[model samples]
Target: MTETLVVDASIAVKWVVEEEGTPLALGLRHGRRFAAPELLIVECANILWKKVQRGEVSREEAKMAASLLERSDIELFGMRGLLAKATVLATDIGHPAYDCMYVCLAMSRNCRFVTADERLVRVLHQKAPREIANLCVTLEQLSAGSD
Candidate 1:
């Protein structure tokens, strides 16, 4: 069976940048189904913008990266129905609603939400402690599975 996962912008950015977890994120793109909330595109773009501002990447490079991501096959789901659940989860976990949107989608789809956010990972394990906790997986965990 194939693996399907909800990935956040943290992971998405790694696809374009040669960051610490880039290899694991790249490994995830190999024959795996990736899904994200429509917000991911904006989040990714914002990340690229920051990189450009910090002079880590050129404006042209950021544009090229954004274009590549937009053209990628990652299925984008609308945020219409996910807002309420995300809000509730965010309040419950003391995390931002934006991050919870991906969690909600992962729960709704019954697949892991893979992320590179260490703080979110810590919160999920420490505070979530139940269904929400179960829905999230760190990049390390997913990468470890292939070994």
Candidate 2:
């Protein structure tokens, strides 16, 4: 199997929608496998819904993005089995469980967890147990060889 990296909704959203760090975010896709909690899909849908509401994208464009994401090569893991662990990590790190799921996945696989949420990074730096904190990285950090 290709070497794997864990990605969260924040990073995945940029794959379909142009935004800051988008180029770097797209770079992470090259020759590497990505894994994430199945909640990734719902999170992407929720983002698209918000984009449509804010007029950032057309309804048709949002649908197209959603379709493309569904067919993307990302590997999705069911969140049910992950819930309790994720919840504990979230509580321990003072971050949302949704974001913690990506970190947990990365920890399990011994790979980097890439996300666009710098707030999560700050929180991890401030509160995440060192082991898990070391697993979280921003898209730019991973892309620029700084991770």
Candidate 3:
């Protein structure tokens, strides 16, 4: 059976938007089960908004990206129960609470949180490697089969 992976917005955004490492993120979808907090759509939309504002993608392209993302097969999980733990993780890791929602979900699922957020991966390895190194894997690392 394919292992379930927790994906954050950084990785999910790459799925619908053309970006560096997008191929890696797209490839990760094949034969793998992806799970994310319910806020994934909201985060993705915000990213698309930013892209539009920066003139990186037209409004129509952003809409298409949103439509594609909405149709994707990722399993969504609620973030309510994750709040306290996510907050603790955010505080402990010096990362934002919103991002911690993904990490906390990964912890509960006992799976790797695959992300394209290099800074999050670096921070996790730097601040709490022993505790979280196994919990998070960068998209590049996963694509290289190093995770």
Clashing pairs in 2: none
Tens digit of per-residue lDDT, candidate 2, span 1-147: 667888888888899889788889888888899999898999999999999999999999999999999998899988777788889988887677888888877887788888888889879878978887888787777787876
Which runs in model 3 stand beyond 4 Å of their true positions?
none
Superposed Cα deviation of residue 132, candidate 1 (Å) = 1.8
lDDT of 3 by residue, 61-132 (tens): 999999988998889999999999988888888889898899889888888899888899888888764766
**Stretches of candidate 2 above 4 Å error?**
none
The residue pairs in collision within model 3 are none
lDDT of 1 by residue, 80-104 (tens): 9999999998898899999999999
**Candidates in order: C-alpha RMSD to true structure:** 1.6, 1.3, 1.1
Candidates, ranked, TM-score:
3, 1, 2
